[model samples]
Target: MATIYDVAKQAGVSPKTVSRVLNGDAPVGARTREAVEAAIRALDYRPSSAARTMRSSRSGLVGLITGAISRGDGSAGPSGLPDLFIVQAIQRVVAEAGMTLMIADTGGEADRAVELMATFAQHRAEGLIYVADSHQRIEDLDPRGTPLVLANCFDAAGTPAVLPDDRAGQRALVERVIAAGHRRIAYLTLPEGMIATELRSRGYREALEAAGIAFDPALVIEGFADHGEGPRPYIASALDRLLALEDRPSVICCGNDELALRLYGELRDRGIRVPQEISVAGYDDYRVISETLYPPLTTADLNYRGIGEAAARRLLALIAGAPAPTEAEVIGGPVCWRQSVTEH
Candidate 1:
């Protein structure tokens, strides 16, 4: 087990310099940083997690409030980010900052989340990162004497939040679909309460309008983000309505790959041909539901990893007693194209 002093000695730098490099407290020259990094790697140096907490009055821990531990559909736990693969990456960032995590499952209930927030405060958590499976409008989260940040949940208050740039992702998707000559495109979404979902829908409509295409409210249909397991029955019923329409859309944009892929089973039951009859597209490139589907879904590769890493960086700032920048910190994303969409 190599110590910081040993690493400092190996790099021929003072222990303070090594600490600065680790904490991101000061700027080290690129060459010096590279040397310090190499010394750490060569010596297999690891920081003392306990040392950080012992030296600081702050807990060296921050709470990640989420509904991740429960099932949706009004179940007793959470179900989103963990399903989307962001939580673990979030943990990695916290660890690098020499901080620990305290996760509280809200069971997807507002009352539970409020209570949990208070409990984390009782534990003297330096700050909080409110994470959701998707974007949600949570009320009264006021930071309660602690600094707060939203992860995967954008803020209307212009507070600090980290979200995958769905606007960029969706705009690119719509542009390609338009370039392919699809004029009548429908964006199927969940309810507008979630920021990410609503933002994606807005992007979809904006893209169409920007191309001189008329926006049709009729083309957008709202469904569910989490049905816990299996497709919601309304999904099939909605597809039936679209398929039965006299002038159906040339392409359908889903809120996510899971919902987009559902079209296979839902439409196939009616013996409809994909791309031939109506092309479908999705968001959030979930591999299983996207790749292995009847036609692999063309969706957005929303950088969940980037979002998690950004969130961890924000949480670290609060933990270190640094003032958070007033400017909204945004870490944006991109798109993933598969075979689900086609030209008119």
Candidate 2:
């Protein structure tokens, strides 16, 4: 099958021109159009359904590469809700951008991401979106000249990315919890070196300072899971330690919905009540996890869908030889005011 590349060369025009002639997006001079047409016929080139869809639908094809943590909840791998939302949102956006999307979940394996990326190239994906389960520093990740977009990924290199303005989310959620008259807040985090770990931690410190409360490292706890990843073991241990403290906090801030849900469960087991004994808050508005949790989680709706759509658009522009975005785009979040937190 002769590709558009073959036609472009035969017609003595750039591939962009060949694409324009094929998509009918830009007007070609009659001479150029005739040349492209003659080349197309001479080569007996046939456009794939994906290319035809691009012409009719106004969107080229794109690839989404996600890295999951390979967690075990009796499932195939890692689980993170924020990343999930972002992936889902990207799906919606690509559809709107006149493009079709193919996604590969890396399951917390950078190798998987690399392999999937190679596959994406094989399919000639016009652009690529790299989504991480958390904001971990990616090492040795190369997209090989494809227009790249990172979702919730924090890397100085690679292509432009969409990041959650989590610093803001933390600041807002923490301040709101504090203003409700809750003092002695606790932040139970995941292992260090995770992206959200750093950002949300910053939010925790800033919030405490804003409230004129001295930051206490003692009150901070990290959950190191034993049985499985959720909110159970770590929550039980953190709560045990926090409650055992000479001065227990009246509120607790969790790293994510998964951890928060676990904390909520453990707190209930210990006869500690949410928003009554201790106000609790979390991040990531995972649909099922947040909506179905006992107290219903109060969290940030990081608009993953919007970010995905934006990435799709950016990739298309890149494929069309459009100017790349001048700077990194931060996808912001909305606070989902649920009943998990209570005003003091």
Candidate 3:
């Protein structure tokens, strides 16, 4: 195997000069750099990453812990698909920053995170990022002095984090629905007690208040059971409650795209025509559900990719000695206007 000395000898330069050219830590004359490059190509020399790490004390690696890849088999949280989008975006940003990303899958086991962190520490990863499959609170992650960032989740320990702005997303979606002339808007929400559910519900109410529409608790209903109780547990009942109202809603805002898709079926079963009779809106603009629906659902993009990118940037900043943020950074996406929502 060709070594750096072999290339240096071939290029007629000292070993220190070769190291400078390889590391780009010091400037070399253009001609000297060109000669070193030619010698490297001729010798096909490969530098030892271990040696580089020892000299610079930087592994040039970022550790990412996530269950998104393991959940690719479709066993995801209540939101539907795994957070693969977030992971992909993180990978892109880290690569662009000239750092390698080492991913560790927890396989749906939250406890495995600590073990994974230890493994990353063993490798001397410059930073660590934990990405949750959903927006929620994560606890008990001890970074052990290595810079850490949470993506799509936040820790009470005040670790830097990037999370989807659920409240702002829901509020924006509802505001769009209101602009479409929906005064009697019914909201079919996720099960109570979830972080996203609570924030999005508040957003819905805030949007209504901003539009001068009185908030009616009667129009809000749980659209599904928590913890995967059943495939389509409460859709029919929720729809029944809304339809039975003497003053039926002109439009219904679903907690997410999955619920909106299921509600479409229930509404069809009852011979209701979408948009013509009652328009519908959804959240998480999941393309599979939103685009394939009859009229193409109007929804909000959760900006999972943006969240991931922001998380990666934050982690890199922390690695560079930036102070941790006191509050989680929130990312928001635009509302997608489609044919499903019509003027009342």
Candidate lDDT values, in order = 0.74, 0.74, 0.89
Better of 1 and 2 by TM-score: 2
Candidate 1 wrongly placed segments (more than 4 Å): 1-55, 72-84, 122-124, 142-144, 154-159, 192-194, 223-233
Which candidate gets the maximum lDDT versus the true structure?
3
* lDDT agreement of model 2 with the native: 0.74
The predicted structure with the larger lDDT, 1 or 3, is 3
Which portions of model 2 show Cα errors greater than 4 Å? 1-59, 67-79, 105-109, 156-158, 224-231
How many clashes would you count in candidate 1?
5
The residue ranges of model 3 lying beyond 4 angstroms of the native Cα positions read: 4-44, 74-77, 226-229
Cα TM-score per model: 0.72, 0.75, 0.89
lDDT of 1 by residue, 243-335 (tens): 667878888887776677666677787787787888888776666667888677787776677887888788777767878767656666666
Candidate 3 lowest-lDDT run of ten: 73-82
Top-TM-score candidate index? 3
Give the per-residue Cα lDDT of candidate 2 at 151. 68
- Each prediction's total of clashing residue pairs, residues at least 3 apart in sequence or on different chains, is 5, 11, 0
- lDDT, candidate 3, 173-205, per-residue tens: 999898877899999888787899999999999
lDDT of 2 at 104: 79
